[model samples]
Target: MIEDPQGTVLALFAAFCRVGGCFMLLPGFSSARLPMQIRLFLAVAISMAILPLLWDTIYPRAADPVASYVRLIVFETLTGAVIGLIARYFVLGLQFAGTVLTMMIGFNAPPSPDVIEDTAENQLTNLISFAALMVLFLLDFHHVILRALVESYTTMPLGAGFNPQGALITLADTLKQTFDIMLRLASPFIVYGLLFNIAVGLVNKLAPQIPIYFISLPFLICGGLFLVYFGISSMLEIFAAAFIPVFEGR
Candidate 1:
């Protein structure tokens, strides 16, 4: 019943290159704890599922004898990697913001294993990043990334070479947008730390004998924790809302 089995197989592998490339760097899927076998199969399965929808586009490019199949494979992989990196960069930006927030608020607890990755991170940073990531999962943010992957065929069709300059521009834009949002989220804590430190410095200046540093640290931690408790909901809301636009390159 099937015609051109060779071409079909070639097309499927081409699809896999792209899908697998995306999953290679995708946030949750790319975590160290996720087995490579599971990642491979999921990429293959998605490639198979999407191949039919993109059959016309991928098959022609893949089946052509002169089309440099190896080149096509490389291009497809890079294209998908670029898309995945955009999302990854945004999440990394949030994690960076969490680190800044912790430093600003004086939450210098011992570093522990990250909830999502293998790296050691401040506990508060771990909490904020993990909560944000979990919220994104709950909101099904991966669905948006999938939609983008599906739509990418039209923009960067099979056999079309990867555009490094364009990809760089897109990633640069994502960083800019991500930095803006993350900075806004952490601004309150930054201001709080600045004001608190200034006051403590003045009090120390007035009372040169007292251990002002030790006295102020507890208050700093307590106030920072209180602010986090009250503001966390809004911070997560803002983070989730900004994700789609940033990922979509809007």
Candidate 2:
């Protein structure tokens, strides 16, 4: 049976739109403020390029006029958005860790522009978030992303349909894990602050004239800076260690 070129072209364009919309919001992919038209065309070009490559794999059989085509577009778009959101959430988790860490350490420099959300994140949050995001691409973490995207095709094929129940559960799990990981990454500062504050409070009570407030604030701030400096490397390492399993199902 000969394949319909018109159907193939329509499907491919639809796929491009779906994928491009996701990339528009995805971290690192569409980092700049490119207009939607340009972004869409870029996505379509890439999709066209890949469509030829995945012709046998992705090409759908033609059915009755109009119904399946609309379904294809909607389903593909939703799935694409879901995939992009999942990947972006992990990056947000990393950003969350940085924000919490900075807040704890008194290092936040807020109101700086953010490439991810295209507004402004706290400067410290922006730094760490950008660095972590770069690391993901540097390490070719997209390999994992692409693997998931491919697996999605097999696990939830083109016409397999959406499952609200499964999506909700997975989204909840991702958010929960994201929060847990952020806390774990920044827990050191929280612990240090807690203990240090307790000691400072006690010292103040015991020696009321010791100039504790001014004296201790500098000491506390310096101590926090030093701890963060020492812990930064380990922080990234810890994130990397825990991050793999979350997406990899390891």
Candidate 3:
């Protein structure tokens, strides 16, 4: 007997909801402050467009109509979210570094437009985050993510049992790797803060009346800005290298 079209569509819609929920929280695609409805539409559109192509290979023909559909939605959403989040992890590294650099350079806590729900990041963090995002896109990191999704189908197929521990491990590794990259990204600024402050301290100690510490802020800030501008290319290159493996495979 032919499967009910209404049931199939409903099943697809359910799958879309789960996938879109993951996208709603994932980075890059959900980075904008667009209305929830618009984001929902985009997510569903992506899912629907891909469904026809991958339906046979991935989405099971609706059978039980209850448990099977539920499992399909859950697994599909988890996979999409995992892929999206892997990319987000890399982006967070840059953001973390920027936050530190900004604080060190006395540029912390500057006003910034809200880009996500519940809060806004510092302007410096936002800038670095945006730049890193561009670099990731330039590297076709999204393609890599899509590839990973394709690979995930083999490791964790739709309607299969969820792998909670594996997902946890992946997420944990992403967070750990992000922190490592952020430290590397912020190294120059950290060094600048250290040596620059040390030099100012020495001068202040020597001449007590010179107020060298106060006088050096502008020089330090300008020098830091220049260094960052010159170093960003290299920084992003390193980031790309670090990001490739996470999206590529196990």
lDDT of 3 by residue, 1-250 (tens): 5366775676567557446755766666786566778878877787676666666644454434456666666666776677677777777667778878987776655567745434677876777777777787787876776555545656766667677789888888888877877798899899988898898899889889997856888888888889888988888888888888655643
User: Candidate 1: lDDT of 227?
Assistant: 97
Per-residue lDDT of 210-248 in model 2, one digit per residue for the tens? 988678777777888898778877777766666667766
TM-score of 3: 0.85
- On a 0 to 100 scale, what is the lDDT of residue 187 in model 3? 90
lDDT score for residue 80 of model 2: 71
User: lDDT of all predictions, in order shown?
Assistant: 0.91, 0.71, 0.71
In model 1, pairs of residues that clash are none
Total clashing pairs for each candidate: 0, 0, 0
For model 1 the local lDDT of residue 77 reads: 93
Alpha-carbon deviation at 136 in model 1, angstroms = 1.0
- Write down the TM-score for model 1: 0.98
- Measured with C-alpha atoms, the lDDT of residue 36 in candidate 2 is 68
Of the pair 2 and 3, which is ahead by lDDT?
A: 3
TM-score of each: 0.98, 0.85, 0.85
Sorted by lDDT (best first), the order is 1, 3, 2
